[model samples]
Target: MNFQQRKNKILAQLASRGEVDTRELAMALDTSEITIRRDLNRLSDEGQLYRTHGGAIPVDQPPLPFEFTQKATANQSAKDNICRQAAALINDGDIIFMDCGSTVFRLCQFIKNRKIKVITNSMPVIQALQNTAVSLNIIGGEYDAARQAIHGSMAIEHIARYQAHKAFIGADGLSAKGLFAHSEKEADMALALAHHSHITYLLCDAAKINKPSYLHFAPLETVQTIITDAALGQLSYCKKKGVKVITV
Candidate 1:
């Protein structure tokens, strides 16, 4: 089979299964693993698929918003590792802003014992840190049932009332253009948090890098640092943009 034919087969598999492994595709197509990787890279650059560590997943034109439970399970290990790294950056008596991103929610588990203040709109983060020594400041606004979080003009106003030492956020997609999200409300909240904090850290898994989403919140330069899994391959691009890329 030719290059185009192999790519078409890979796309077909991605469409049916939602994801495809490099080695598995190589075996099935009777091609070398290197060739499969090249095809995946090409397809990913074309925005047809999203390349992962050893595989690729179909790209959603306008990324879908995942529920709290669904996001908690997807890439759980990667999220845990990233959160651990982020948790270490916190100091005692520091005030922090936590966004309602699922990956940011994982940081709550690792930092529940810390003696720091947490201002957030995430119900999950509030629940996770309620019994801990961490001080909780919940942002009040209209509740979003689908996201299980609070967001609106009031939430933005509430966030602006306080400043933080650091703000940790998550995005549906990250590219050279900036951070992207499926919901405009979430984007507005993230922007507010970024503006109110001294430093901003973007917490996301490798799969989200270079993936495009519906709403562009802010540019890569807006955040001080980006914490992600080691599978991300855009370090050069990030470095060129003057954004610190921390791979856990």
Candidate 2:
């Protein structure tokens, strides 16, 4: 079959199965793995799909676009406490770089009409701050439907112009090994925020502590502080690394 036909077949298979492996593609197309890999790369670059380490998956799915209310309900008390403390770290009018995550969303909820400017990639954060008196700027970029955050050329271009006193990030996983995220785009964006802001704070629940997700964002030494529950069981590691650990 020709290249276009092969790509179409691969996309169809991915759409039907939600995910497909390189080996599977080779078998289905009667082609070599290298050729299939090239097709996957091309399709991914064309915004036709997303390629994982071993295989490919649907691009526009749950994580690329997230639901705020469902996520907000998962860990109510932890999220709330984290938010209140996160808000405390901020001066009344400090400009902040807040990323998408239920925890950061909780922080946005805690500040009641506070005088602050929030620059974020989450649609939920934008919605939360828009009703309140907090000044907000929503970075427009490629919207990843699964994570519900925008990251790409547009988001980076807008974020580059602003310097924030503090940046709050929510990570998918963390450990003595390093800080990691599920998406390479998100990992890159988080690193950009850490470099852009004066201080970068990572807000994670105990559930994420010491876990290594598929993608690595940055190292623990790169982060200024890590805010989590005292029960996360990795406080010792954080302390040893000179990472200020905050427990609520």
Best by lDDT: 1
Superposed model 2: Cα runs more than 4 Å off: 1-68
Backbone clashes in model 2: 10
Could you estimate the TM-score for every candidate?
A: 0.72, 0.70
Error of 1 at 59 (Å): 38
Model 2 lDDT per residue over 80-190, tens place: 677778888888878889887768766865664688889899876775566566888888889976667798988888889889999998888888877988778877778
Residue 183 Cα positional deviation in candidate 1, in Å, after optimal superposition = 0.4
**What number of clashing residue pairs does each candidate have, in the order they appear?**
0, 10
For candidate 1, write residues 114-169 as lDDT tens digits: 89999999876776676568999999999997886899999999998999999999
Alpha-carbon runs more than 4 Å astray in model 1: 1-66
Q: How accurate locally, in lDDT, is each candidate?
A: 0.85, 0.78
